[model samples]
Target: MSKFFIFLFVIFIHHLSLAQSVQLTGSVISGTEKLPSASIQLKIFGNEDLFTYGFSDEEGNYKLSCEISQSDKFLLIAAYIGYQRDTLIVSRTDLLKQAIFQHNFNLKEDKKQLDEIYIKAPNAVEVNNDTTKYNVLRFTSPEDRNLESVLKKMPGMEVNKDGTIFFKGKKISKVLLEGDDLTGEGYKAITKNLKPEFVEEVQALEHYVEDNLLKGIINSDDIVLNLKIKDKGVKKIVGSIDAGLGTNQRRMLSTNLISFINRTKAFAFANHNNLSSS
Candidate 1:
C-alpha cells in the first residue's frame, strides 16, 4: 500500500512541474519585415501582476516562459516605435511542444492639420490657429538632470522642494502615465525618480475629471498632468552617473540605470554623499 501511495505522489509532482513550465514563442514583424528590438509583455488577463516577458532580437524573434495554471488566461502586449500596439490572447490549449505563433504589425504615423474650418450660412471660413505646443524636449535639457528639475523650467509649471507639482497657480490633482495611475505615492514618486529622458510629452488638462452631475462644472482652475511616453523610449536602456566635489570638503556620487526589453522594465539608482574622512 505504501508503494502504491508513493507512485501516485511522484506522478502528481511530475504533472505539477509540467503545468508550471510553459513556453511562448513568437516573432514580431512590421509590414512583412522583421522588427528587431521590439518589446513584448505578458500578463494574466484582468490581473495587474506581470507574467513572463521577452524581447525580439536582431532578427525579430522572441520566446518567453510563464508558470500558468489551467484557469489562468493571458494577454500579450507588443509595442514598438511608430507602430500601433498589438495584443494577443492565449489559452491553455495554445501550449504545445515548441508551438510557434507569428505576429505581423503595421505602424501608422500620427499626423494632424493645424488649420480649422467653420461653416457659415453663406460661406465657409478657414482659420489657421497658431497654437503653442509643449513637448518634453521644449522644457527639458541635459543640464536639468531629472524630471523634477525639468518641470520647474516649463512655462506655468512648478515643483516644490517637497516634490509636489503645480501649474498655472493651481496644484495638480492627478498625474497619469498612458492614462493609468502609477499605483502608490503615484506622481510624487515618478516625478522624483523617473529620468527626464523617458518623458516624451506633457499635456496639461483643465477640469480633467468629470462626473455625471459635474458636467460643465468647470474645474478649469484645477489641472492634471498627463505624461506621454515615446513608444521606443520605454524599450531601450538608459542610465546616468554623476560625481562632484564641493569647496566645503563635500563629495557626492550618484548613478541611475533603466532598461526595457519587451514588456519588462528594470531600474536601479544609488547616491552617496560624504563630508568627513577618518
Candidate 2:
C-alpha cells in the first residue's frame, strides 16, 4: 500500500511540473505575409540575460517553451531582416492563467532615409520612392570575390543557382553597369567577373522602364539592378592573367581585361588550354 501511494505522489509531481511549463505559439507576419527564418528571443523582464531563443519555421510559425513560472515577468522579441522588431510582455498572472498562450507579431517594413552629409553614414541603407540603394563598400567583405557574392548579403535580395538575381521575390530584368546595359538579360558577364571592390553602390530599381523618356508614362513592373562603379576604378584597365602547367605536359592560360572610359565600356576574355599532352 505504501509503495502504491509513493508512485501516485511521483506522478502527481510530474504532472504539476508539466502544467507549470509555458508554451508560446505565434506567427511573425509583415502586412499579411508570413516571414520565415525570423529570430525569436525570450528574456526576463528585468534581466539582461537571454533565457531562450528560437527561429520561425517556413510557415512563419514559432513555438517557445520555457520554465517561466519562476520569473515575475518575461519578454518575447521577434525580429526579421529588413523589418522592424516586435515585442510582447507576459506577467506571471498571465502565465498562471494559461499554460498554452497564443500571440502574434506584426512587423512593419523598415525604410531608412539617410543624408549624404552624415559623417557616419558609410553603411547606411537608403530608400527613396521606388529605388533602394545599398552601399556596396559597407557590405563587401574580404571573402567576397565578385559583385554576386556581395549581393547575397543584402536584404530582400537573392541570387539563383543559375546566376539570376531577384529582389522582393521578383526577378530583375537586366543589370546595368555604370548606367549602361552591358549584358541585357545575361548579366552574369559582369556580376561574375567584376570584383566587389570596384563597385560603390547597388541600386534596386522597381517598376523599371528601359527607356528614360517613357519611365513614368509606361506601365511596367519590371525590376532592374544598377551597379555604380567607383570613380577610381573607372577609366583604368583591371584584370588578371592565370597560367598553369601540370604533369604529362598539360598547360592552361587565361586572361581577363576590363575598362570603362568616357562612356565606353570594354571587356576582353581569352583562354588557351590543352586537353591532352603533345
Candidate 3:
C-alpha cells in the first residue's frame, strides 16, 4: 500500500508541471510581408529573468513553451535586424486560463539602422578636418588599369585630357605619393602611370601648405591629392607594359614600373611611338 501511494504522488507532480506550462504562438510581419528568422524571447516581467526563446520559421511562424511560476506577469519580445523590436505583456492568470496565447508583431523599419548603413556603405565619403578621403576600391572596376581611371569616377573630382585632376571645380596644385611630394606640379607622371590595384585610398587636402614653417603663418588656397598605397610586403613591384605593331612596320611601345620598399620609392617610365606626321 505504501508503494502504491508513492506512485500516485509521482503522477500528481507530473500533472502539476504540465498544468503550469503554457504555449505561446506568434508571427512576425512587416506590413503584409512576413519577416523570417525573427527572434522571440520570453522573460519574467519584474525581475526580467529569461524564461524561453525561439526563432521564427521561413513562414514567420513561431511557437514557444514556457513554465509559469508565481509571477504575476511576463514579457514577450520579438526582434529582427534592421527592424524595430516589439514587446507584449502577458499575465500568468490569463496563461493558465488558456492553453495557448496568440500574438503578432508588426515591426517597422528602423531609421537609425538605415542611417548606420549609409555611414558604413562602401562608396560612403568621409571628411575629417581639412582632408577628404575616398576608398579607391569603391570607384575602381576591373577595366580600370591606372589610378587616373578611378579618379574620373569619383564624385566632385574630374580629370582632364592631359591627365590633370580637379576637385570641387578647383585644379589640384600637386599630387603626393604616400605623403611625399615626389612628382611636384607634374602629378600626371605618377597618376597616369601608377596602377589602381596598388592604391587603397585617395585623399584630397584643402589649403595645402608645402612648407612646414609657413603652415599657420601663410594662408594658401590649394588642393592637393594624396595617394595611399596598399601594404603588400616589405618590397612590392607593380607596373604594366604595352607594345603594338601597325602598318608599314611602325612600332609603339610603352612601359611603367613602380617599386616601394620600406621608406624608399622608385618610378620608371618609357614610351616610344613611330607614328609621326608624314
Candidate 4:
C-alpha cells in the first residue's frame, strides 16, 4: 500500500502547485489612446525582488504569469520612456480562477512654466564656474554614428576610456531619455548602448533634483543628462553600425538598431571582435 500512497501524494503536490500560479493580463492606454511599447515590471511588495517583466504589444496589451503563496502581495509598475510611472497593488485575493483583469492607464505629460524676471541680457554673463550645454544636433550629422563617438565630441563632456562620463568635475549618475530615469547603473548603459541618431538634443542640468529641500543637502554635486528623442511618427529607424581595422591586424565591429512605429519602439544590438597574431 506504500506504493499507492506515493502516487496519491505526488498528485496532491501537483494540484497545489497549480493552485498557486496566477496570470495577470492588462491593457495600457494613454488619454483614450493605446500606448504601445510600454514597459511593465512586476515585483513582490516591500521587496526588491522582481518576479517578471515584459513590454506591451502593439495593441497596448501585456500578460504576466507569477507564482504566489497564500499570503504574497505584488506591486505592478508600468512606465513608458516619456510617460509618468503607474503603479498598482495586487494581492492573492485578487486572483480568482483563470480570469482576465483589464487595466487601462492614462499617462500625463511633463510640463514646466518659467516666470518672467525684469532683467536685461548682460553683454557677457560671467561664467566663472564651468558650465556647458550640448545641442544634440551639433554631434549628430548626416552620417550616422554610434552614441559613443558622438558623446566624445560634445563640448565640456568627456567619455573616459573605461566608458564613464565626467561633466565639469562630477560624474553623471543618471541619464534620462525624455525625463525617464534609466535606473540601475543608468549612464553606463546609456552611453555604451544607445545610438546617437535617435537623440534630438542633450540637455545638461546641474544641481538636479525634484525637491528643493533636498538640494545641496548632500555635499556631492550632481549633473543630469537629458536626451530628447525625435518624434516617433516622423522618424521610424534610428541607429548605426560601426566596423574598424587597426594596426597589428586587429578588427572590431558593432551594430545597434532602434526603430519606432507610432507608439511602439524596438531596440536590438550586436558586437564582434577579432585579433590576429604572428
Candidate 5:
C-alpha cells in the first residue's frame, strides 16, 4: 500500500510539472514609438537550433509561447530592418514563475549600416499620393540575373512557382512594363527576361477603373507593379545568338534580340528544338 501511494505521488508531481508553461508577452519600441513588424526570436543558451520566432503587430505588441519547461535560461532577440538588434538573457526565476512575463525591447537606428546601403534617402522607399516607389538597385545583389530574381529579394514581394505574384501577402492583378501592357498580364514573361540592370525603380500602386461614375463607389483591391527603365539600359540594342551542330544530324539554333530607343521598342526571339513546328 505504501509503494502504491508513493507511485501515485510521483505521477501527481510529474503532472504538476508538465502543467507549468511560460506565456511571454512584450512590446518593441524605439524612442517612445512602437516598432511594427519587429522580429522576435527565442533560443536556449549554448545550443544550435532551438529557435522560436515571431513578429510584433502593428502596435508593437507581441505574444510568444515558449516550450522551455525543460530549460530555465535562454536568450531573447529582437530585431528590425535598419535597426540595431537587442537581446535579453532570461534567468531561472522568470521561467519558474510560469506566468505571463513582460519583456520589452528597445532598438536604435543603425546609421553607419544605412550609409553603406546602395540607395540613400532620396531614392529609398517613399510614398507619394497612392503610389510607393523603391529603387531596384538597392535591393539587388551582384549575382541576380533578371527582374524575377531581384523581386524575390525585395520586401513585401513574392513570386510563386506558377508565375503568380503577390505583394504583402495579397494577390497582384497586373504587372506592367513602363505604364504599358507588354506581354499581357503574365508576370514571368517580362520578369524572367527583363535584365535587372535595365530597371531603375519599381513603382507599386493600387489600380482601379478611372470612370467618373464608378470612382469611389466601386471597391477594388487590384495592385499593379511598374518597372521604370533607365536611359542607358534601354537606349542601346542588346541580344544573344547561338548555333551548333552535333552528332546524329542534330542541329540547335536560338536567338534573342531586344531594342529600345527614343520612340521604338522591339523584342524578337527564335528557337529550334527537336520538336516539329510544321
Candidate 6:
C-alpha cells in the first residue's frame, strides 16, 4: 500500500510540472505573404541567448513550449531570410498566469537599397520596452576600432581596462554580440575584436539580473549589455603569419586565422616552439 502511494505521488508531480509549461503557437508572415520557413526565439530578460527556439513550417505556422514562472518577463523574436527581425514583448502580469499563449509575427523584407530621397536615419539614443539603445554610427566617429571608445561617450557608462563595464557606478552582468554570446568569453573578446563599422546598435538592459523574473524575486541589481551586428552577407578568410630567425639559433613563428561565414564564426591558432609572450 505504501509503495502504491509513492508511485501516485510521483505521477502527480510529473503532471504538475507539465501543467506549468507554456504552449505557444504562432505564425510568421511578410506583408500578407506567408514565409515558407522562419526562425523564432523567446528572449528572456537578462540572459544573452534566447530561452527557446521555434521554426515555422511551409504554412508559416510554428509552435513553442517553454517553462514560465511567476514574475518572469520575456519577448518573442522572429526572423527570416531576406527579412528584418521582429520582436514582440509579452509581459502582462495577468496574461502570464495562463498555461498557454497564442502569438503571431510579421517580418519585414530586408530592402537592400533605398530610394534617392534624402531621409536621415535615427542616429541618437532611444529606449524600447526594457532596452536602451544607441546607434554607434550616429554617436561616434569612423576612426574608432573598438566599442570601448564609443562606450565612454555614453552617459553613466564607464569602461575600465580590467574588462569591467560599469553603468551608474554599478557593474553589469554580461555582454552579448548579435543577440548571442558568440564566444563564451565576456566583454574583452568583443570590445577588442569587433570593429565599429559592423556594429548596428548597442543595447543596454536596465535592472535585469538573472533574467528579470529571477532578479525581481531575489532583489538583484545587475544590468545587461547587447550589441547588434549587421549582416554583410559576405564570407572572407583573414589571417597573418610572422616568422623570425635570430643570432643564438632563436626562432619565432606566430600564425592566426579567422573566418566569418554565414551563421558561423571561427578562430584557429598554431604555435610552434616556446616563445616569450607578454
Best by lDDT: 3
Which segments of model 2 are wrong by more than 4 Å?
A: 1-121, 232-235, 240-256, 269-278
Error in Å for residue 245 of model 3? 9.9
TM-scores for candidates 1 onward, in order: 0.39, 0.53, 0.49, 0.39, 0.53, 0.41
Clashing pairs in 2: none
Candidate 2, residues 140-198: lDDT per residue as tens digits?
77899778999987755779888899886588899987678878898887788777877
Q: Candidate 4 lDDT, tens digit per residue, 1-278? A: 99999999999998786567667788887778777656676677887355666556668887877666544677777765345678888766676455654566676643321111112111111111223345455445555445767776653456778877765435777777666664535566666777776776677677677466876675446677777776555458666788889987888887776666664555567778785321
Model 6: lDDT to the true structure? 0.65
Over 4 Å off, model 1: 1-11, 14-18, 96-278
Model 1: per-residue Cα lDDT over 165-208, one tens digit each = 87645688876665555533457766776678877777766665
Tens digit per residue, CA lDDT, model 5, 48-79: 23346666776888788755656657788887
Worst 10 residues of 4 by lDDT: 116-125
lDDT of 1: 0.61
Q: Candidate 3 or 4, higher TM-score?
A: 3
**lDDT value, residue 75 of candidate 2:** 84
Q: What is the C-alpha local distance difference test score of each model? A: 0.61, 0.76, 0.80, 0.63, 0.71, 0.65
Better of 2 and 3 by lDDT: 3
Clashes found in each candidate (C-alpha, N, C closer than 3 A): 3, 0, 0, 0, 0, 0
Q: Between 1 and 2, whose TM-score is larger? A: 2
Segments in model 3 whose C-alpha atoms lie over 4 Å from true places: 1-123, 232-234, 240-254, 271-278
Model 6 lDDT tens row, 177-223: 55555555366666665556666788888766545357557654657
Q: Return the lDDT, model 4, position 109.
A: 43
Per-candidate RMSD, Å: 21.9, 14.2, 24.5, 19.9, 10.0, 15.8
